[model samples]
Target: MRRTATGLLVVMAGLFGLARWMEPAYPAWSFVRAFAEAAMVGGMADWFAVTALFRHPLGIPIPHTAIIPNNKDRIAETLARFLRENFLTPIIVSRRMQRIDVAGAVGRFLADPVPGGRLRKGAGRLLADALEALDPERLGTMVRGGLVAQLRRLEVAPLIGQALAAAMTDGRHRPIIDTMILWADRTLDANQVLIRESVAKRAGSLLRWTGLDERLANAILDALHKLLAEMAADPDHPVRAKSEEGMAELAHRLQHDPELRAKVEHAKEEILDNPAISLWWQGVWEQARAGLLRAARSPDTAVAGFIGDGLRQLGDTLQREPRLAHTINRFARRATVGITTGYGDQIVRVVSETVRRWDTETLTGRLEQTVGRDLQYIRINGTLVGGLVGLLIHTFDTLI
Candidate 1:
């Protein structure tokens, strides 16, 4: 195309030269001479205009010529401004984003198993990377520090009291009280001889001298066993009721009594202050970290399976719930607007800065490569238009 445009210009110049020579030989050739002269002039003018856009004509400096190379910075700034004002403006960006069903699109992407799987795998890889990057020993120390900090905030006594209270609700603690009683009764039965000897020794010289020590010890042991059995057999036993009443009082104290709460807090402080408390937590964390590391490496591990299932469930939720989808889309829209409004200008400046950093010659060559062929067409149009105008002027002159 460039060759064609250039060749047309050359041919027009040659034709004008021929017409100039033939004009003197034949008067009728004046019209041909006039057309060729105008065409040659028009072609040259367009050639200069096009050349000036990218470079100086014939390497000679002219005002506003070499427009692209000389005004590179100005051109970049203008382009950048145009983009910022017209394309990246909040209104324009928001409008474009509003056209998209952001969450629905995401839901569709997730519903397609391929993309969902890819997303899941990507998340897993990220998790694996994070796990791999951590030093287990350091992680344990961090865990220990975190645990101690958390434990310091806790009052174990109140928690236990509250737990007991909750357990006692609706007679839930009755079975526990029964079990305690039964265990105590069995212990007495199992060690009857040991209990007898201990009681007889405590009986002092009076019982031993009476020769009634063995029978008396037996009677005492049977009475104690019978009492234990009574406690176990009767849920409404006085001891059981007393125990429940004591627990209820303790729970109320934990919840409402300031002095008891203070004691609980003091105990919490003691536990946290212990040096070995940190070590215990560190050990626990190390064990958990080891298990996690093992789980991450195994594809068929429960943790991996759980993660996969969670991802699928999330995808399914997105697909099924329109309200959730809308909420997600609303968030996305707001985020998009915020980013565009906040940093859009700076982002646009990247274009101008990049252009400014480009070498002049390189920029000029690239511009010319992109638009040179189109500029050649302008030359062709000029030649044709100029010839027709010239012919009209000649005919009007002849008529006058």
Candidate 2:
């Protein structure tokens, strides 16, 4: 483009030379001469204007020339400041985030089944890399230690009390009572032999000889079963009412009774002090580490499948539940706004610093690549436009 524009200028100069020589014999040649002269002036002016942006015109140390290279630092600062003011502010980020449904986009991405399962594989690889970064032994020890510290600090009695209080508030305790009754019935069935043995031991030799002890054991089992059934069937049974009262009292004592709280704390300490618990944790940690390592190694198939299913399920749930999706979107927007608000200065600093670090040639070369073509066209336009104006002026002169 530069060569083409320069070539046009050279052609104009040649035309001017030819016309000036011919004007002695032909008056019409003067108009051609005027046009060429004007074109050369316009072309040179535009060329200089374009060249001055990148370097000194004709290699002379012209003032206001090489504008970009000379003011590189200032340009970088201005650019960064522009970004900070217009793009990185919280209001800007928040507005942008409002238009973007981050959660919905993520859900769709996760749910979409790409060719060759690329999304699932990418997620798996990411998970594998994260797992590989952690030393399992160290992570396990840290986790166990943290758990112990947390448990030590935790007041179990109060936590349980709060849980019971919450459960009782919505009549949730009824389901628990029902479950306990079912389990009690199962326990009786399981311990029938023990019950029979106890009955046999308590009975006299005469009753045993007549098989009366067996009948007595049967009766005892039936009565216990009947009692459990009654408790299960009748929510307002005397036993259930008494049990609920006992639970309410227990919840209160757990929260307020110092003696009971101390006993619960002591029991917790004993559980922590038990060597069996340590052994159990060690076994659990080892199994978990092995399982994770195995999954990480073959995540493309194993972990990916599980994760992909979960993602699809999550996406389906989000798609089904507008409220959940809205909540997630709100959280995403808030999080994005927070990040922009917190790190905007640093981000702008990075932009400025990056631009400032570039050498003059590199900076000039990049800018030229971006806008140099349009600038060359400007030279071409200037030449054509100038020639037409000159022709008009020559006609005006002849008319006058």
Could you tell me every candidate's TM-score relative to the true structure? 0.52, 0.72
Query: What is candidate 2's lDDT per residue for 157-271, written digit by digit as tens?
Result: 9989989988998899999999999999999999999999999999999999999999999999999999999999999999999999999999999999999999999999999
Report the Cα lDDT for candidate 2: 0.90
Number of the predicted model whose TM-score against the real structure is largest: 2
- Candidate 1 stretches with Cα past 4 Å from truth are 21-29, 113-321
Model 1 clash count equals 0
lDDT for residue 337 in candidate 1, whole number 0-100 = 86
Candidate 1 positional error at 231, Å: 34
Please write out the lDDT profile of model 1 over residues 224-341, one tens digit for every residue.
8888888887878887789889879988899889899998898778877888877787777877776666655553443336655775677778878989988888788889989989
Off by over 4 Å in 2: 11-39, 117-134, 139-182, 197-213, 223-299, 387-400
Model 2 compared with the native: what TM-score?
A: 0.72
